[model samples]
Target: MKDRRARWYGGCAPGSRPVAAPVGARLLWRDPALWVCGGWQPEQVRTLALGSARIAVLGPCSATEHDLARALSAPELATVARTWAGSHTVVRLTERGRVEVLADVGAASPLYTVRAPDGAVWGSSSLALSSLTGGSVDTGWLAAYLRDKHSPASGLSAWAGVTPVPAGHLLTLGSEGGMTLASWWKPMRRTPHEASTALRHALGEGVRVRVSGVPASTDLAGMDSTTVTLLAAQCGPITGVTVHPAGVTTGGDMEYARALDVPGLIRSPFPLAARHLPFSATDVPLPATDEPAPSTAVWAMFADQLGTVASAGSVCHLTGDGGDNLFSSTPAHLVRLARSGHWARMFGDARDWARLRRQSPRPLLTAALRGNAYRIGRADFGRPKWLAAPVPKVSAPTGPDADMALVAELRTVARSAYAELQLADALGLALHNPYFDGAVLDAVVSAPAEQRYSARRYKPMLADTFADLLPDAHRTRAAKGLMVGDFHLGLRMNRRRVLGLADGRLAALGLVNPAPLRATVHAAALGAETVWPPLLSVLAAEAWLEAVERAPGTEWTRNAPTPAGAP
Candidate 1:
């Protein structure tokens, strides 16, 4: 929901004076040994207290008192947390004085832990925790992020000494200040038909809990958003917002968005003007994002859409961000089919895919016959030409090629989703992506690989599950909306602004070579087919550095104890 003052910081301190809430912060829940503080609205924070044990559920959740008690009494808390209806973070205090924090399955609701002399501290904002711990930027982590932007670095954040709780794991702190992460989740296994039923239920419940009798909004630009918009419409007053690019269009998103005919849904179409392009806001400081986000580089384009939603008083804004990663299958799925002795189906699918990409079927068949096509060895970590520093030997994904590829892609998309949430928060809007919910993810992953992909059909599983709700024009749509041209045009128009970053933070820190970096930016600005991810990553990191420097820091340390009621 829309809560501009959601920035919060809280932690447990053993044998230390109780901390007073920050001037503008609201006390969520407090005890002698633990305190949680944030600028959350009263409705946003739900708590259950029982003697020495207590639990708090933050964000949108369908958790009841019974659920909290059961979680507190259960041997493993994450199992129960996984069954919750909507996206949320769970903070629990045990009678034994151990504190546990469970973040959502996605990076958007990340929790960070920092060790202090007195006790262990945790907070939602890495920037907030960094200030209290006197943390500086972790250049090593930044380098790793640039090298493996798709697969997020485990157990590290942008701030030095700030450890993020990995997704699907619980962060627990012992009474003596020791910390550990316990495995609490795994993908569910089910047949395609069973998974379709489970997915419908999970996704429907997820939306129901968040928007029941509330004012909400959803993006109507793609299949993912269209489905979410339809669901939200069944509940209460809902706004369907769409942003159509002003310049040369790519896909039929604008057409489908305009053609939508929902009985009660309010359609709001925004045309993104030419001035609202990436790199146009290089002169302006961006929102305080924890890490480098490529989306932040293009924040200028979405300001109007987000601002308009916030102004309309919509509590929550939904997007279909994680849908592609969850539903779309890669070439590795073909490998699975070939290994299972489905020769006819494998060859047929390969031919269909080859025709779409304008390539011969020989390579696809060869790759499928080879089984796993991934390279996860140390040699896989190669330094790019623009990078000046020695690349670290980062850990690579293991297991089957198909699974590893999907995990890596999901993690990458989660990071971007989290970045968008942070930016939305800055504009007084709470952004939600239900597809990232653990249950929803499990439902998607549990389905058979063959059922999830088809070269001829577009997201067949999603389409078939919600076929009745989809428009006839969009149900069989195959083309995807592309922003490549818009991005190129933005760079060309603001070449001088981009060139100013040749000797920027990354170059000064010796991470990237100024000469090669400048050449890459120039070529990209001229609309050459340049490698976009690494180039955008460098620029994103540069912009993040500038933004963090401009933002004010918050301290989470406790205030001194009152002097025997002398006041």
Candidate 2:
């Protein structure tokens, strides 16, 4: 009987191999498919048991397996993730066969579960869950997916009826077969110095583990990667790469990458293929599920860069992906001030934010009064008016309106980061991010909101936090490099692909109307606002649906992996 359950864990997807038994989430087979979402990776599974209860820490974790087990066994359930310092997920099994799963606040490791009459099926892979149950596409989810072309604000996956264990929540499966979810990480406000101290410790430690005391290199895009490269060098000198924009895109990344002169600073040709006109899937990753990778064009370049890093004989690479979302928020922090009745600070912060962004304070104050209407894309697709998304369900944050705006932005960032994780796994390389580190996240949220956003002191924070790590010359070189120029080329080349979205699966599902979307593409071809991001996401979804249909087999029988793996 024990062996039978173990077999179930290994073959959740056909052709998947198990790396020994994992405790807790018994239904979650440690297969390759589930590793992509977050936390668990194919080679990073570790398990420990005590008496009857058992625990598994999957992905990058600082605690030794035994120490992690001891922490989970504490009377306070939150202790399980409280002491951990890296991106990971934890699952604990009780004597009664009940299970508990916990993911970090970033939801860096996504956990998707489906309940059946026999038992519950859970894993990190959304596509695997869909295949296991023969699930149909959920139109509401499809609506939301198109709505969130860039990043996902909610924990839900695209597969209908398959539930995502929300980030920072304790998800438990009772022995009798029921489940309960509740928040575990409680963030408290902190003094600026206190927050800085915590970050210094957390960020330094985060980079160290990924480096494993070996020399490392990081992508130098801006302050985020720049700070990380500097921190990694404290332990030992590390190299950096600048994915300089090739083609018509303006500004060079090398000026920034070269300034932080540590050791081997190489200029990699990460051209944002301005040639793939309309929308290039040329060597781009396909979405196997509803993972919203909004910036596909940029990602193609990132994918090429990762391959270069791997070939350079580096074991791990550091990233500052979550930096902006975690550190540099916006005036939205004022919403918390107003909500809490700190009227004086609210007014002051708004005034300061307006000055930094070079806008009038009146607009900032008015926006705070009305609350943030977080708009990622145009409200609806270019419409026959009938092409509409379901009214968005706003999950009012526990604090203030700005929280909604900031959280929404972070969700998109997380989705992009997760997509990059897939690229890393494909290249057999490890990527470390201090911004998403559990400790760094808790510390950032605890800082006074004014310092983070209201004053727009991102550059100052970057300088102050890692002052020792950064080079003196690079301190003042703060201009950002953007790929706005690449978009113009992408829009022209992918005109047909954009047209396909209007006439494709989305139109058939009533998720979009063909006529207006078709016109939008024509207008884009004629050099209007180029292409809309929502339209690009729809094309990404169409590609995924087509890939799913193209698969010759499901979970029951092995399907040949597509270009981006099983859908």
Candidate 3:
């Protein structure tokens, strides 16, 4: 059980580690015995018996042992645990003859259990439970939910038999087969008047917190001093505070702020007074070279052409010898295809297929691609007839730098196009740059072909937005770091292992096209050219399917079982 939980938290493969914490601390209680192995935080494991119950408390400092005690006495023995501190807790409760389990408000940790016909329960993940109980994971509901929500959050992991203790909820498993799941906390609802007050208060306080720690010599850049005064006056009182010289990038905001050793504040917003600065459009030229175009130039040109089409209100269709067409003629079909392997494959290709092939597929890449494509294609084209063209080309300079320039040009073009179409009626255009959402031409150019085509990668314009908000030194600095990569390194260092529980089932289900996937992997390893987006998407989808198959209560049988007495 510990090994399984560890594998899941540590990421079974290269990128699968737990998002919250290490498996040992994640699964085992930091306190005394009641040891738990394999889970992320000790609080995720709970022991409940008739007379006493022990639980690991993982979460913020605001959530404490006293809070758990109060929850245990609540009507449903459910409590909302919000750990003010960073780490989540493991909970172990031993009663005279029974015990109950509850997760934190955020479900940041992992817990799995299995129940027998006679009411004995065991397992950490549904996959583990399915193995123990000869059951299958049920993912139909999960699939439907993801199709609607774009994520598998709703307390459902990839497997069935294993159920996640929902965020802000509690779960109780008895010696019998009966189980009870209940919500302990719900979103606070307020009247319009209250909401307005809350918003104003929150904004004022947030601003104050953001500015409180700045050195007196800190310049407001182009901002007006009056706006800062007004914001300070608006905020009644300041509790936790921190100062950031420049606004932080949306991606690095949290970590950057944390690294500063500040508390209770987020990235600073542009001062209202600063809005008056004449927004200058500074075009940074891409690296120039007199050398002739290399073999890779053709693909680069094609990508640049596609960016031009995207800029000019046309959806570009990406087709490889063996991959699915990324941009379809139909918007709805395009979305579906994008959701599958189309987008990821493109991103994989753009990031350099060889590198992508060596790495397992990342769903975040898929989401990023789909998101960028939708933002660029839908915003620029909007069901225009031009999208149907077999191959669209823009008569622009075919230099290596063209791709980057095209993206910058596209940003200006897209904003205008969207304004003309009144697309703002459907989507709100914020003061911050739209390129922040991974919709920039340079990001596409620098990315592998698959990634570039899929429209996922960090956009320079978005980075510039933060640059505009930060001190000149930090603003000009390159190298946006990633927390996940660090976490992945930690997991790999732990060397956690996962059993091949679903390999055979995955093969039989035809969930993934193994031959192409293997080929792509081999190609990547050998530094050979390969189509990335399709291959990645196929691989990710297959992995997801395998996860689904291993979930609890899922049955892959072709027919219903016969009656007990039937032959």
Candidate 4:
């Protein structure tokens, strides 16, 4: 079977100006003002040239050539993206002689662009774009990353001058080379039943689009994965991979996975033992991704499962990533409710939430009133003690008032998943995350706020949407499995290597205070009260810097001849 995946880059130049193909990429198609190239087999790319317009939909696109031409007739990025059934990046030269690029809504296959002298150049890989622009890591962005690894710096890349085309937004270049962003996706308000129906349709279509008569695999542990796994089984044969803590007879995900007695389901259980712990192998080099992959920090834990999936001849692995972010609620919702004078609902939710956490409702309401969306605790308002310099202030993305916090969080999570996709690519497996699909998120968020979130019911909307397919016990289970013990054990074992990071690149760049960082690592190894996010963020940053420094030089761009009558 031909591989239906690709890594691509291209540029749209002014009339008759030439754009050179990047190194290691074969030119797929080229015209007078635009060029497309990729590292892919012929089956991976889809192209169409219609009246007064040309478009290239790269990476596993399911849209037919006729569909592309029809969408091109309208010449709107969002419309074109909507016409396409599968997740892919779109590069279109509009009839107005402007360039428009639409990245997938979930950013599962995001595109990055850099403004060139002639026009804007774009590629699937940020690192490649950085190399093309001769750019270095953006330390200011790094500062923001360290400050809030959970929330990515919106529209900013780790590499300077390389910007991610924000998810669901259209990147357009004017004739004279000016760039602009226009949002092409928005959640529509719908009744609870309408939203649920839309969600079910979107979810089912999302699964079917990826199932191409191939052996498929999925994580069958979490609520999201369980829902996805059972759905995939309905379409075709799929192996549901579940992990259970070795030597522990019960508890965690196995029980939930075992409950599903569906046909075409192959139960592939993997034992999570000491070998899969983080830092299990210190000598092995981590895969270099386009950005600092914090997921790589714990990649060892998933390697065995990936190997198992690979052995099963599964080409596409669907994960339930982005589901929790899509389905869960935050304190922001409470504040929104209070401002709207839904006082009774707010208090009820606060009381219910407080009961679950075994805390008083007063604190939750107080935190909401105070505009603290993260938590109601000893709020650390200033810079962290571990950082050596002041970080840049990152403003929240400006958007719809409803669930903007959750949207921001989901974008950040999707960016993280995008980084993890890089690692999966290195392993020669395509990671498909349907929950991150734009249509699915739109369907979920379109439901009334009350339907989307509830204190007494965990992911009430998600549970209700798939109630028939999922068991009540699996859907309503509030307890989540934590691998903190495994991580801490890794910390204990890799104490020296982690401590050495203090004297590493970040310390050299004055981004970290070695002494405090070392102290944090030491305390974490000893199972003391220590914050791991900052430590792990620093480690990821240091590892990225190390990888970037050691990576062999590559020229992603080369000079090509300008066309006749050009400047």
Off by over 4 Å in 4: 1-10, 32-44, 60-66, 83-86, 282-284, 359-363, 370-382, 397-400, 557-567
In model 4, residue pairs whose N, Cα or C atoms come closer than 3 Å (at least 3 residues apart or on different chains), thus clashing, are: none
For residues 1-567, write the lDDT of model 2, one tens digit per residue. Answer: 001010112212222332222232333322222222223333356666676666666766767756766765776556756756677777766555556777677666666777643456566655556665566776776776666544343545677777777767887766454678888876776798988887787777777666655646787777778787766666676767766545534455665564555553444445544533336655644434335344453445555666667777765678778887666566676555666788998788777766766767876666566555343111334323425656344332433445445544564466445655654655556666667766777777666655565364455665677777777655555447554455656666766665666787777887877787777667766667644566566666776677556543223323313222212
* Count of clashes in candidate 2: 11
TM-score of each predicted structure versus truth: 0.90, 0.81, 0.34, 0.90
lDDT of 3 by residue, 1-567 (tens): 112222221111111112122223222321111232321223332322223444444321233456656554444444333212221333434443234455433232335554433333432334434543554434442332212212233444344555445433455544343557665543343443443343333323323333333311111111112122234333332121122224553333333333332222222332112211111111211111100111111222222322232333321111111001111100122323444657654454434422433443343344344443322222121221111112222212222232322333332222222111111111111011111111111122233332223222222222232333334433333333332332223223321211121233334543333344444444443445544323322333333444334433322211222222211
lDDT value for model 3: 0.29
Displacement of residue 162 (Cα, Å) in model 1 is: 1.1
- Runs in model 3 lying further than 4 Å from the true structure: 1-35, 38-54, 58-80, 83-98, 117-123, 135-157, 189-507, 512-537, 541-567
lDDT of 4 by residue, 197-269 (tens): 9889878877876765777899889899989998899899999988887876466788777788989999888
Total clashing pairs for each candidate? 0, 11, 93, 0
Q: Mark the regions of model 1 whose C-alpha exceeds 4 Å error after superposition.
A: 1-3, 6-10, 13-23, 31-41, 247-251, 282-284, 338-344, 359-383, 560-567
Instruction: Give lDDT for model 1.
Output: 0.72
lDDT for model 2, please. 0.59
Per-candidate local distance difference test:
0.72, 0.59, 0.29, 0.71
